[model samples]
Target chain A: MNLEIILHAGLATGTVLLFASIGELLAERSGILNLGVEGMMLIGAMTGFSMALATGNPWLGLLLAMLAAGVLSLAHGVVTISFQADQVVSGLALTFLGTGLALVLGNGLTGQNAPLIPNYDIAGLAAIPFIGPVFFEDHSPLVYLGYIFTPLVWFYIEKTRPGMHLRAVGEKPVAADTMGVSVYRLRYFYVFVGGCLAGLAGATISLSVSPGWYSAQTTSGQGWIAIGLVIFAQWNPLRAALGAYLFGALRRAILDLQGPRMILGFVNPLYINPNLGFFLQMAPYLLTILALVIGSRAAMRKRIGAPAALGEPYIRGERGL
Target chain B: MAFPISIAIEKRTADVPRWMPAATSIGSVVAAFIVSGIVLWLIGSDPVRVYGFFVRATFGSWAAISDTMVKATPLILVGLACTVAFKMKLWNIGAEGQFYMGAFFASLVVLVPLVPAGTPAIVVIPFMAAMGMLGGAIWGFFPGFLKARFQVNEIITTLMLNYVAILWNNFWIFDRWSDAGFQMTPTFERNAWLPRLSDLAREYPIFSGITLHLGVVFGLLAAVVVWWVLERSRWGYEIRLIGDNPHAARYAGINIARNIILVMMFSGALAGLAGMSEVSGVVHRLQERISPGYGFTGIIVAWLAKLNPFGVVLVSILFGALIVAGREVQPSGIAQMIQGFVLFAVISSDVLLRYKVRLVRTRADQNAAGEAA
Candidate 1:
């Protein structure tokens, strides 16, 4: 109900999605639709939690998470790009692998807490009323890092030379290859980068958001939501930030509305049967379908900004261009 | 064109031999199991013992074999469902959701008193099956319609719908259908339950304690029907043609959109039947964990079986073994890991079926004049 509470809750929740969507956005822009984001994130979460728990260093955990996921994504690239396997099936397999690996590795870490990512507060910004508490006060350093990276991502895609090449690879791989651009290399690089970011997203959940290593469902469906956010954001990092926050807000609201209703400073419980709370959880997924349906329809009539060569493997001089 | 050595990966000019697929498939499975065995060893478990236990638990006794069949029943149905749509190049990833929808609808038949308590088992069972199929078909229709109408990606739509279906089911079970706060409906009346193999044990002692039910029969029957349709029916021709080349199929005047919807619905109906079968035969009541990822596992089944209906049956049985083995094993995730590896191997092995890769070193000194030299 209040601006400060909502904004605080929304930004805290949104950081995970933001990290994931930006990574996926980058991968998609390079013409590889990696559906294994969820899997990678889960693997990342498990590895990060394990590393952090072992070393008592959350930073090390986060790094290892990115590394593990990057390696997994490379496997995906090899299958989809080099072997010409179906992208969708390969991605799904990657997910299953990640989930299984995470479950196995995470068995020992359940109910155990690892080091938490430290929260930072800006001196001057924290002093400001309403705005300060909502934006700058008592948030994880990862949140600020995400804030800085969002604009950087936008600039990198919009202004840099490699960014232009990335867009070209996604839109017209054959044409890009003809122009001396290495489509294969660019796709491999972006897909790996996406995996790294997904790993960080997982770290964000364990180290900062939930602040502990849990079971296989720790990352839950957040990775899938992030994938949906990529389309909802129209493949734009800046817009993805907004989309993530919107989803974050919806998620936060559901949490606040359920339970004892104390989060809203109300006495009466908002959930009538308490099971009504479960149905409310369906909103984000329902919203994703609606967004895809509408976004794709608009795309047909106008440029909805999808990379033209998305999901298609580019094999040099293969036939039937 | 002669060089000291060169590496080339070229498409094979000739068609692959008939035995290649089976050979590669068996090779892949063996490779996967070996890798998983190594993993098991690394985890401090004796791989041989684990595997031996797996074999014994899945096929050790009549009861164990019957349990495996019970597990395979849904996988076969869902696998057949996926094969149909996938054969037509339609990605029906919503099978999990459709399964839940089917279960939801089937639950209503008994929960809502749609039929009288005294209704014959024969009557109520078929009605529930029909309702379940309808539910799954309707779930499939939305993504099919969207793909046909708006070109929305079916992969995303189907995946998203899965959560929606799951959450919707949870809502009902937690709120209205909870049997004294338990996350399940009350046990169905005996008349509504699918007759278990043990029910026949009254006369035959061998049938005792065998949990196998009519679902396996339904699965086998469905597989035969699917194989017949795909191999012999005119509709199968249209579906196959579209899968091979949609542009050519469209040029040939096939109604691509309608066929996509139809095939997708048919695919969903099978998955729905899987769900209904689970509730009616195995659980005998709608519950929160009605399936343990059977729908997703069915994807692996369909692919591993090469989308052949009979292959689905065989592969489903293999996967059913894994499911049963997982329960008996110390670590449940090991079985899941093997399934995942099997999928990876299956997908990667396709490259071998289509192309041949050979490594050779290119001599830089006199590559062009090497033959003359």
Candidate 2:
């Protein structure tokens, strides 16, 4: 119920969405709108948990998780990029594939213990005021990594030669192709990168934030939330980080709201009738919808939109977006 | 030395053969089975034995076949739901949510006792069905309205609403309607239940033990109706046009926004009907997890059926078999895995429809041919 604790937990949980949305951002930036983040994340969570259990090394588990999800993303790349299938349908199929694979592989791993990512406090930063305790205090190393990762992604996408090429491929594949950028190769590579990040996000949940596999419930539509965050962030890494943390805090707040029987001198309906917590549980999702509405309106008013060629297949010599 | 051969893919300029699409779909299903078998073998399960058991358990007996049909009934409705929305290029991933809402609404007939006690089946069933559709339609309307008005992505909106809908159902089931604090409501009286073949066991002794319900008839009727709507109706043509080319549809003066809302409602209604059918025809009570991902499975069914209404029915039957057999499968995810493979194969197979692949010899072989000429 404490503000500091909720914010701290939010940072830890937000790291999961941070990695996933950034991954989705990378893929969309390359004009491949992959809706399979949920599937990839689930696969990552399952693989990370099982590998951590089998090898007794959380680091190896993390790497394998990324690789497995990366390989799975390549499936989407082949279908959408090479075969030129409909990206939406292919993405949906990828989710089914990823979820199925994770479920099958993770069948008996439930309730089994695994090595987890360790939490650490920043020495000087932890000693600071409220910001220090909430932001820099004891947290999964992934949370600290997320703090550094967001700015790095922003730099990579907004301030580099490769980033320009990435933008070009997404915005105008024909122009980028004429400039000697291999549109197909770049799309495939970014899609893979996106997959890896989604996997990392999934691993963040299993080995770090929440810890343990709960089958489909392990990722629990957070991957989908990440995709929504991408849209809400309007494809900006820094904005995505902001949205992710805010959503994380909001999710934590929803859970915490059920704890207090009295709020601001009044009784809490949810606390009294625990079943009403179901409605409370829906806050994150409802908020996501609210965020999308706001995001879409902002985009409309500001003329900031999705990548120009997002969701279009880049076939050579084709007349298309 | 360099490789002597290279693979080349060239886009097709002409339409494919009439039978090609169907052939590719069938071929994809076969390929999916082979791939799934490989996966099973990799996991140390004998694919043959598992698949053998699948056939035996799903179609081994009249009873097994009837059970599969029972499963297929809901799928058919949900598949049709997907077909209508997908035809218009609206990815209504929230059919799962819409289905839940539908169940909740339909259950009100018995729980709230909307009708007086002992209402005849003739009056109760249709009213329940209509209420179910109304619930689903309302659930769908929000996303549709948002997408049409604000240009909000319906995919995300619909998906988000799914969680909300499920939780909404949970609140009722776990609180107000819990049968002695159980997670489900008490069983409805016989009048509220859909008439099953077993209901006539006395008059027709041969039909004894059969659980096939009238919901299958609903599924069949829905398919025919959906087929007509998509094929014969002007609105259907408009939906296809909007899906294929929105710009052209707009140029042709089609009201895209209105259609988006309407089609979504229609789609949600079908899915709602599916939920209603499940509660009324099978479970005979309102409960949670009544669907083992039938709403999700319907998406695959629609795609595999190529959005053809009658094709949905056939695909649902196959998936029905998979679900019925999946219960006994050890890994428990084998059916889902197979479905994933099927979708992958089907989409990959679409390449054959759009392009021609050929093996070409390298420069040396070309030079040899030139010399011979």
Candidate 3:
């Protein structure tokens, strides 16, 4: 109910959504809309959990997650970009393949606890008694990465050479091909990098944020939310962070709102019930659909944004149907 | 000049025969199997023994082969659903959701206790399944409508519906999860079960290994019906024309928007029947995890079959063998590797169909003109 609490919840959502959204932004930016992000994230989460438990190292677990996701995502990039298969189908299949692999491999970490990412104090800021804990305490390095990576990502795209190439390949691959840019090379790079970003996002869930082991549905629909985040942010990294935060707040706010209860039945019921809870749990998913629909409207699609060349395969010297 | 030679090469590319693409697909699948065998060997499983066991186990016995056919029924139906819609460039990826919806509605029909004990068994059974098909078709229509009207991506809408269907099922099941009530599944009346063909199988050798329910028969029938529609009907001609080139189809007086919606709905209906058929036939009731991601696998099936209904039958049966074989393999995880490899290759088959990679030589135009290379 209070402003501060709402702000706090928003901050949490931002951290969770930013990781996957930013990765998707990069993938879409290359005109390779990867639907396998969810698959990669789930694998990343499981791998992160296992590595953390086995080695008792949180950072190592995160690294393992990224590696795992990167490898899994290769199939997607190869089939979708190299073979020129339908991007959406390839993405969906990658998800199935990844999900299958994760479940099979995640058997070891089932019901076992893994190492957690701990918050470290800032050198000077932590000593500032009241404001210090509120600002600096209870925040992990992963949160900092989510925040700091935003502007850094924006700069890379708008300012750098390879960044320009990535955007060029995305916007007009044929033009880039005419300019002697290797379209396949650029696509492969972005897809692989996106895989790494997705992996990091997965680790954030299992290693740093939630800080424990979970299986299968562990990543839940965070990957899809990340996809939604891409549309919500209009392919902008900084805006992506804001959108993620908004979603995360929505998620925790519903959980934090079970204070008072209603009768189970229409008439004066015998007991208070969480029957309304199913709708509550579905709030995030519903919100995502609404966001996608609103964002894709022609009047709004360009405004909220989708990558111009998203899902279009680039073929040089030929535009044959 | 070299330019004239280049034109000759391009002409050759255009002249490739129609059956060549399918031949290439089969070649790639075979190549994938050979490579995948190496992966198995590295993982310590004997490829020869494992494959032998897989073949013998899945096709070796009557009961096992029948189980394989049963398993493939839903996959074949869903694959057909995707093939039809996707050919029209309408992606209906929510077959899993539609399948569940079909199951949900069919389950509703099954739960009714009002049917008299002496009522004709044949009448009630088909009616139960019809509701399921209707439910799936309705689900498919909405996304198509949305895509046509609002320019929304059918992919995301269908994907989202998957969860909606899942939650809908959960909402119903939660009510039945209480103690003393059924947990995993509530039993359906004996009358609703698919008529088993175990008896008919003993009398017919070709069908001996198959103990099919009505669903398998319907699946094959549906495929034949779809094949006929796609090949001989006016609508099928329009779909092929639209898929090949919408501009031409429009010039020929085809309604593009209507076909998109129509194709997707029909696609959804078949997929829905797939889900419902399983419940009314094999499972006899809805349970948690009713489908083993059959909707998604339909993509692979469609691709493997090259969108041909008869091909879907062959590929679905092949996949059925894989699934049956996958379970029977010891230390079972290796089967997934085989599946992943096959799917990867099947999807990648499109590449060979579209392109012919050739190594170029910088020889003079005179040499190029005389050589087939």
Best candidate per DockQ, number? 2
Per-model DockQ against the true two-chain complex: 0.52, 0.56, 0.30
Write candidate 3's Cα lDDT for B126-214 as tens digits: 87778888889988887788777766677777777777787777666655432245444576777777787853766766665456888
- Candidate 2: residue B88 Cα off by (Å): 1.2
Whole-model Cα lDDT per candidate? 0.86, 0.92, 0.76
In order of appearance, the predictions have TM-scores of 0.95, 0.98, 0.87
- lDDT of model 3 at position A77: 88
Residue pairs with backbone atoms closer than 3 Å in model 2 (clashes): none
In candidate 1 the C-alpha lDDT for residue B41 amounts to 86
Evaluate residue B9 in candidate 1 and report its C-alpha lDDT on the 0 to 100 scale.
65
Candidate with the larger lDDT of 1 and 2: 2
Tens digit per residue, CA lDDT, model 2, B1-373? 3877766676688999999888988999899999989988998889899999999999999999999999999999999999999999999998899999999999999999899998999999998899889888988899999999999999999999999999999999999999999999999988888999998999999899999999999999999999999999999999999999999999999999999999999999999988999999999999999889898899999999989999999999999999999898877777888898899999998988988766776565343112111
Quote the lDDT for A110 in model 2: 88
TM-score of candidate 1 on Cα atoms, chains taken together: 0.95
lDDT head-to-head 2 vs 3, winner = 2
Top candidate, metric lDDT: 2
lDDT of 3 by residue, A80-189 (tens): 87667888777876776666667656755767878788876567875676555544556777776766788999999989998898888888887777788888878888
Interface RMSD of each: 5.4, 5.9, 4.8
> Cα RMSD (Å) per model?
3.2, 2.8, 4.9
Where does the lowest 10-residue lDDT sum fall in candidate 2 chain A? A312-321
